[model samples]
Target: MNDHDAAGPSPSPEHHPDGVPKFDRRMLESLVCPRTQQVLIYDADAQELISRAAHLAYPIRNGIPVMLVDEAREID
Candidate 1:
């Protein structure tokens, strides 16, 4: 079999080469601040997911979005 067939299923959403998470509309809408349940804004320029209410921004590294609270960076 070819490599495609051997590979079976596609890669996970967190492992894209572009360093941007492949978030569907539903998923994006569902992602709220764990602490405040506030909406998040997608910052393409910064390549991060920002929660303004929480003053937190999650980074996307090598196409993988770091969603952990501890891994997020504080924004001004």
Candidate 2:
């Protein structure tokens, strides 16, 4: 067998079939709200990180979470 064959198929990039980058849920394990330094809840429907303590909703753009306080929306 050739070296290429032995190496096997190349690893697929982390993305959806439609070309959109996939959000890594594993990141939530280490992620925290910038303002309150508290755990965040993932809102898949809104694509945001909800910080209950801070009353803020951080947006997720292009599959990347915007953790900056300036970028966060004030939640009711």
Which candidate number maximizes lDDT? 2
Q: Which lDDT tens digits does candidate 1 get at residues 3-67?
A: 99998999666534655565443556767766678888877667678889889998766544677
Per-residue accuracy of model 2 over 1-76 as CA lDDT, tens digit each: 9999999999864875666666779999999999989999998777899999999999987789999999999998
Computed on alpha carbons, the lDDT of every model, listed in order, comes to 0.73, 0.88
**Model 2: residue 49 alpha-carbon error in angstroms:** 0.5
Q: Quote the lDDT for 76 in model 1.
A: 91
Local error of candidate 2 at 8, Å?
A: 6.8
Which has the greatest TM-score?
2
Off by over 4 Å in 1: 1-26
**Clashing pairs counted in every model:** 1, 0
